[model samples]
Target: MNAVNWGILATGRIAGTFAAALRELPDARLLAVGSRTAESAEAFAGENGAIRAYGGYADLMSDEDVDVIYIATPHPMHHANTIACLEHGKPVLCEKPMAINQREVREMVEVARQRDLFLMEAMWTRCLPVIRRVGEWIEEGKIGEVRMLSAAFGYRTGWDPAGRLLNPGLGGGALLDVGVYPVALAHMVFGGEPTGVDAAAHIGATGVDEQTAMTLTFAGGGLAQLACAVRTNLNQDARIDGTNGHIDIPIFWRASTATLHVEGEAATVINEPSGYHFEAAEVMDCLRAGRRQSSLMPLDETAAIAHTMDRVRSAIGLRYPMDA
Candidate 1:
């Protein structure tokens, strides 16, 4: 099989991590890196071993050899960047919180569908082996009717009004940055939009949420209590409780192991590699199969999760400048 030529559309930290993960895959090649300046693009290219570097996003979009473009820009840039790639007839794997709002996500997905181009939200957690095993266990009735889930992701950070974590203009907030993990996991395990969502947030002086909590109730009476914060250190753990047993997933976002506790049986611990290669491989597989979206992380599910987030924001009155 021919190697997939990957073009990275930003020089941020996440972009570098993804480049490293791509290098670990034999069927992938880092073809190009793009940034707002020639110097930054050249530097990223040098570090990532890319064959070429472009001074601007448009240049990267026009590159003929790039089989897929990874939009690793901040949350607010995802919609516009993904749209540009799809317009150029290039497949895209956009970073998480796919867009600032569900409206933008719908537009991005619509463009990809109209152009018959592959597009996927780069929610690596969905593609990880341990998370997939969680899904499998649920399907096999090992968990026996999952009824509740609890997840929390948080970390204390010093105040920086202009930084990505606190800036309203950058779509900064705990919800979009880290809350999406627990939200998406709930959607993945519960399997639909919540019937009701109740949330509260601590809107900081920067006009962005510093912390948030949510209670989601599914139609089938399943419940999920989730929390995310940028002002406190949280356990960053997750659990799924069922009629028969529960699964404990520590550091659930990028978890490599999970312990299953059956009602009256010895616990089983499952393990896998902790890396982003699985999601990259999934994107390549979709491209090779001529599929427009991943079955594992479908566009509809992405939009649904975004809509749920919009609801949470609405309930908490957390409006970004972009919403104005």
Candidate 2:
């Protein structure tokens, strides 16, 4: 039996979740943790029982014992941080919205290809058992050819204009933050970027979108209506309507469960594991097989989703402060 040594970079809320999930996988070890400040790194490491705490990113990448590094940094920092890890001959699993733009995605993929290291986006929702059931139902023709998809994910976050939610410098806004969930779902289930993009947004004083609504028209005439806002509350349900039947997912973005309702008969429910364990289990399984990337959450899928999201951002005139 082989074990995978994991190094985690970042010390935020999501990073903590990732660390906790990795701890549950016996075949995977939380070998080290890195943060901008050694104090935070030490704190996170102590909390998670990680073996080592690095003062900075370089230390984690150079620690030799780490077989993989999870890049859970902010959206704007993903490309740079991921490249640094790959340069150290470490595989990376970056969190979603891989970057603020497609150009950055290209750069990240380029570095990984150049180094021949495995790289993946932490689009964990796609790999969950519940979402897998949703996809399976579609494949089984439980839902006829997908005709329409609608999803809404939004919450009123009253963060200052310079905070993560409203700041342009932080790649802020509802779109890149919460909206990516709905967008990724549409792309993962429907396949490919939409043919047409139409959008309306409530732009904040900080030049970031506070609320956005978009309609994506696919080549087959199917439509996806996506709405995300930082100014309102939403139920965050996702529904896929087809010619025969429709499947609905509640709390769809982070869905731990889903229901398949066919044209007739009773609806079937699929439940999944808790939190980030689903993705962590996948990482451990891949590591045991000596594989770099998970077959379920490959880097290519992440890049494709990023590309579609790039287009969506353009159609809606959403630009980050880092945009050149």
lDDT of 2 by residue, 265-305 (tens): 78888787747877776766776676767777666767777
lDDT: worst 10-residue window of model 2: 283-292
Q: Which portions of model 2 show Cα errors greater than 4 Å?
A: 290-292
Tens digits of per-residue lDDT, candidate 1, 71-179, equal: 9999999999999999998999999999999999999999999999999999999999999999999888898999999999999989899989999999998999999
Q: How many clashes show up per model?
A: 0, 0
Instruction: Quote the lDDT for 230 in model 2.
Output: 88
